[model samples]
Target: MVKKNDQLIVTIEDIGANGEGIGKYQGYTLFIKNTAVGDKVLVKVMKAGKSYGYARLMEIIEPSAFRVSPICPIAGKCGGCQIMHLDYEKQLEYKEDKVRNCLTKIGGFDKITMEPIVGMDYPYYYRNKSQFPVGKNKEGKVVIGFYASRTHSIIDTDHCYIGADVNIKIIKFMRSFTEKYNIEPYDEVKHTGLLRHILTRMGYKTGEVMVCLVINGKDIPHKNKLVEGLRKIPGMKSICLNINTSNTNVILGEKVIKVWGETYIEDYIGKVKYRISPLSFFQVNPIQTEKLYNLALEYADLQGDEVVWDLYCGIGTISLFLAEKAKKVYGVEIIPQAIEDAKVNARINGIDNAEFYVGAAEEILPKKHKEENISADVIVVDPPRKGCDQKLLDTIISIAPKKVVYVSCDPATLARDLKYLHEGGYELKKVRPVDQFGHSVHVETVVLMCASSEAGKC
Candidate 1:
């Protein structure tokens, strides 16, 4: 009987995927944002349905023990971090439970081994990459920051709690530079102005930084002055421009123009040096990336003589890691630029056993297996959010690698794909969730599966 604008007091019992609190009142489920489990809160129903409804948190009558004061003053208003209000320990626990629940409820795994989640000792300031949108506020001054939750409206802030500390300096420089030149901030509504977004990437180990300004036009006014100002900053290695003349939500365009310095910045992930360009799909967190990849390598369990196939290998991050232990590794990716980067990374690292191919994994893997009779003893797949394609799954089953290591970003799609693999005669062995994104609801999980015949043996 609950309708819109109904006021009620509810006890939060669970947290949803997006970090919303779930509470039940008289058999009706209410989802409220900015509230955590074990909290008793007053809420007003925003959109009421028959069995479930969305509500807005009015007041917290009692706070959860796991809840903590977020380091960022604008944590609740900014869309960057979802679960920052929750303690880091509880955040790890929730992510572990999320993976377990997905496997049990969605994958139908009645019994499965799940290891404890690997978390960072210090989660804040871990992000090596940050993108800020540029726009004008109500007062007609240039504003730069992340968008508010679920809205395109930018929330002006000098610093992001989770991003690299250098981001603040960069933002400040841009604010002043824009003001001095009277540069126009891109207006998404009217499709006018010039600068749209600013992207910055840092090499956590190398202390190298790259800045790419996304603009609505091909060039920026007073580009030399902008470059000079940016070069004054420490570790400034690359300054570039990304032209996206089209009116679209997508951040980057196909063309990238180097304004100053190098076109790419070099970084290391476990001794493997990688040259990261502005368009590269590198993991944002370097500390946790090492842990995550090391876990994947352990799951791969290469004996120094195994032939491994790395599917959807971006810039050869995981592929090169596996190649260090495996006798030979073949990496397949759909993006040509990524494959080129992978090749360059392998050569730069002096790794001769790794090879890169440019094509869709589903199409290329099967063709290679058929034409070259290339069979792998172990297979590693780091698929996108949508998970592996059915054809790729079928090919893996047919190849029958002794060990199949799957690195997933989405738990739901992962569960669905795991079900497909399990039905195809693979046994789920070990599942470990890694907290790559600390406060965000997103988590990365690495799973180990073995052929049915070699289940317990592995």
Candidate 2:
């Protein structure tokens, strides 16, 4: 019987959904982290379950062909990037397979066509946004880095390989500034201290950067000194302070005060300009985002005279993209700030045919469809990781749009939502997985579905 602390050799047969390597020994399933498929490893079982167990990889006896030395020394310790041990090419393949498996196993559809995963040429250092948690390590010193795995403990990294180059400099500057000013890092357990997190946002194309500091209090002592230090860096657009006094896992607070520069920074994605604020849901990878949006536009197949609806529209990024080709586009988001940004973004791009609304997409769509008899030729949905609510899926079916373009971040939820849509009369067509987050387990996918009839009817 497999017991805790048992050291045994195991051969990794496959990669699990969470990027952990799965192996079996004497019919006991073991999940080992920092491992790769086709590798044989000596693992020490950490915990034993009834049918499965978790392990810590002690040594890789035989490395997989896809295995490559990770770029970051603490890559395995940090939760930011998974599958970093796997080669980039194999990573792409794994992501594609993940999407395919989700659709097949969850959606229960195997006849769908899958396009080659759109990957980044230069995958590393592509992240435009980064949020570094500030906490004290075991030595009781101020540490700034990502949370280690499932724990809130800091890994104390000087640099993150996947984050923007400017992030390292910003973190270093903050570390110095905090230490000099005698600012204490927040202790979640005791619910004491001030500085909690350091968030950095960069505009890849425009070369703009925004640094926002999260604090337990409303103000920071020696704020001017910190602002002046941050302004020394070129392209620093905005510096803001977000106050989160609550003792919770949430990073940002309800109140945000600008310390220096503008409250928001500007960035362009394929001719469409967007003003990204601290809370805006902008895509982290701009280069890959353009490709992902372009692929979505392609799948949308706008013919210059279509009425488009973009649900869960974040600052009208996709709505504006589709507006140029469609006759008119209507965008709906639950967040008022996002809706306001959407309207401003539309005006910035000189797009007059796009309209914005603030309400729950599921509720608003059904209400609009009933009261105004609204109809759409193409409906584009980019819901949260939880995917579309069942009511939203039912609403989409009832509205009966000619085409549905789904932009999904989570494959399992995407497949489930696709299943609901497919059962509602839309035929599953083409699926393209875009690697927006390289070196990470996350994969963004765009799917195209068309109604069986020209005038969609349930």
Candidate 3:
């Protein structure tokens, strides 16, 4: 019988959704992290359950052909990126399999077409945003870095390879400024101190940067010195302060005060200008986002004179993109701030066709469709990680748009929602996975579906 502390040899047969390697040991399933598929490893059972167990990879007897050396030394320790050890090509393949497996097993789809995953030419340093937690380590020294895997404990680091190179300089400057000025790092336990996190956003196209310091209070001592140091770095457009006095895990507060520079930074995504504030919900990867949105646009197949509805539209990013092709586009979002931003974005871009509405997609879209007697030729939904609400799916089915474009962040939830839509007489047409979060287990997918009556497949 398998017991804790038992050392066993296992051949990893598959990779789990969380990027852990799945292998069997004497009829017991073991999940060992940091091990790739087709890898033979010696594992020590950490927790042995009846049918499944967790293990620690003690030794890799044979590495998988797709295994590659990890670029980040602290990749395993940091919760940021998993599967960095896997080759980039293989990572794309694994993501494709992940989507397929979810659709087939969870959605109960018999046959579906999955296009090749859209990957970055240079996957590293693609993230436009980085949020490093600031806290004191065991030695009582202020440190700033990402939290360890599944823990709030901060790991001291000088740089994050996946983030913008400028983040390293920003973090270093903040650490030095805090040390020199004797600024206190926020203690999550006691809920004291000043600095909590350093949030930085870089514009890939415009080369503009926004640095916002999340603090326990409104003011920081020696603020001028901090701003002066940060301004030394090129492309420093905005330096703001966010006040968060709560004891919660939420990073940003409701109050945002400009400390030094402009209130917002500008970025362009394919001729579409976006004015991003500190709390705007913009895509972290602008390069991959363009590709993803382009694919979504293609799936939408808008040919002017079509009325398109973009649900869960954050800041009207996708809605604006669709507005250029469709005669009229209506965007619905739950957050009032995001809706305001969407309206501002539409106005700035001179897109009179797109209209912004503030409400839940399920409630607003259904109600609007019923009251206005509106018909959406194409409906594009980019829901959050929880996927679309069931009522939203019901509404979409009831509307019976000619085309449905679903942009999903979580494959499992996407599959579940897709199953509901499929059962509602919608047939899955095409799906293309986009590697927006490179080196991480998370993948973004764009799926195209149409009603069976429209496709003549029913």
The candidate maximizing lDDT is 1
lDDT of each: 0.94, 0.92, 0.92
lDDT tens digits by residue: candidate 1, 236-344: 9999999999989999988899999998999999999999999999999999999999999999888899999999999999999888899999999999999999999
- Winner of 1 and 2 under lDDT: 1
| TM-score of predicted structure 1 | 0.99
Report the poorest 10 consecutive residues by lDDT, candidate 2.
Answer: 449-458
Segments of candidate 3 deviating more than 4 angstroms: 456-458
Off by more than 4 A, model 1? none
Q: Decide which is better by lDDT, 1 or 3.
A: 1
lDDT (Cα, tens digit) per residue for candidate 3, span 1-458:
99999999999999999999999987899999999989999999999988999999999999999899999999988999988999999899899999999999999988988999999889899888999899998999998999999999999998888898889888888889999999999999999999999999998889899999999997988878888999999999999999999999999998889988787888877889988988899999999999999999999887798999999999999999989999999999998989998998998999999998998888888788889987788999999999998999999998899889999999999999999999998999999999998889999999999998887531
When superposed on Cα atoms, how far off is each prediction in RMSD? 0.8, 1.6, 1.3
Provide the lowest-lDDT 10-residue window in model 1. 360-369
> Pairing residues by index, what is the TM-score of model 3?
0.98
